[model samples]
Target: MDLTLHVWRQKGPQDKGKLETYPAKNVSPDMSFLEMLDEVNDGLIKSGKDPIAFDHDCREGICGMCSQVINGRPHGKQEKTTVCQLHMRQYNDGDEIFIEPWRAKAFPIQKDLIVDRSSLDVIMQAGGYTSCHTGGVDDANAMLIPKPTADYAMDAAECIGCGACIAACPNSSAMLFTSAKVAQLAALPQGKPEARKRVLAMTQAILDEGFGNCTNHYECEAACPKGISVKFIAKLNREYLKTMIPTSTDA
Candidate 1:
């Protein structure tokens, strides 16, 4: 299959970028989207031109590093699929694919398809942890958590911090990603002690990093590669409200 790629190219964060066209000839339908880009890069190298730059690691889609907006959709149009997991076969021959870095104030473009997603790291650092001093691992059976709660926690923990939620949102909100991180721990007894502080700190960090607020657009949940639900965002809102409500001082 042959395709026309309009890829965003920028030398550095300060450099103004544009969508440069390149021909992807004889692209294999079986090739992963990154592999197709690899082939295009190889051709550029041979031609003494700069190759396209994109972030990718652990091509198995576990890393969530392959961040790209393909044809107006983050990680392409495939539901619940990351860019690394997307295959070239999804496109037809002679398709004109527009590839760009995630568009968000919080995720400034580094070069080509790479963006400074360290804002997410900053948010993670702000909270998303419990400082429990349990020295050794405890037996799984020791904790009497309901099975449903454990399952929900596991589901929330599947978030890979891909930042797709922000890219997909009209307001460029990080609420879904932040909420998932909070929910992963907040659902469990282990995360209860720090729950109040965790949600407050993380949500504040998101704002400090210049991320937009969630307006219930639902785009974040729709674009999440891990299928993390927006219900986590609601949970976060409730948790945040806990901190805002005044407590009784008199006994």
Candidate 2:
């Protein structure tokens, strides 16, 4: 199948970018999206043209490195699928694909389809962890957590931090991502010791990074490749508020 990819090319963060058209001929239906890109890059290299720069590692969709906006959607329109997991069978013979790097101030363009996502790392560094000393793996019965709570913790822990939630939001909010981090720990018994501190530190860090507040558009949930629900944001808000309110134990 033939495909025409309109890809954005930029020299640097400060450089202006424009869409460049390239023809992808005979794309196999079984070929993954990154494999299609490899074919395109091979064609470019043979023609003495610069290849498209995009991130990819562990192309099995386990890693969130395959970051690109495809046809007005992050990771294409496939539900719960990353770009690397996207296959050409989803498109037709003459389909025109528009590809671009993630557009956000915090994730400035590095070159072509590559963007710096280190701002997320900075936010995580600000306190997305529980510093308590967890002893070596104890027997399962030792920590005795309710099954429902453990399930919720794992549900929230599914977040891969792909930034799709941020890109899909009209407000460019990181609430879903932040909330996922909050909930994964908040629901766990081990994390209860620093629950309030974890909530406070992460909330402030995300705000300081200049991400917009959640406005309930729910685009974040729709765009998440992991299907992490926007309900996590609600959990975050409640948890953040709990941090401010005086509890008998915290007080």
Residue 168 CA displacement from its true place in model 1, Å: 0.7
What's the TM-score of every candidate structure?
A: 0.96, 0.95
Candidate 2 has its poorest 10 consecutive residues by lDDT at 125-134
> What TM-score does candidate 1 reach?
0.96
Candidate 1 C-alpha lDDT tens digits along 111-168: 9899999999999999978896768988879989998999999999999999999999
**Which residue pairs clash in candidate 1?**
none
lDDT of each: 0.93, 0.88
lDDT assessment of candidate 1: 0.93
Collision count for each candidate, in order: 0, 0
The deviation in Å at residue 231 for candidate 1 is 0.7
Cα lDDT of model 2 by residue, 38-134, tens digit: 9999999999999999999999887899898999999997989999999989999999999988887778889999988887887778767877557
Model 2 Cα shift for residue 210 (angstroms)? 2.3
Candidate 2: list runs displaced more than 4 Å: 134-136, 248-251
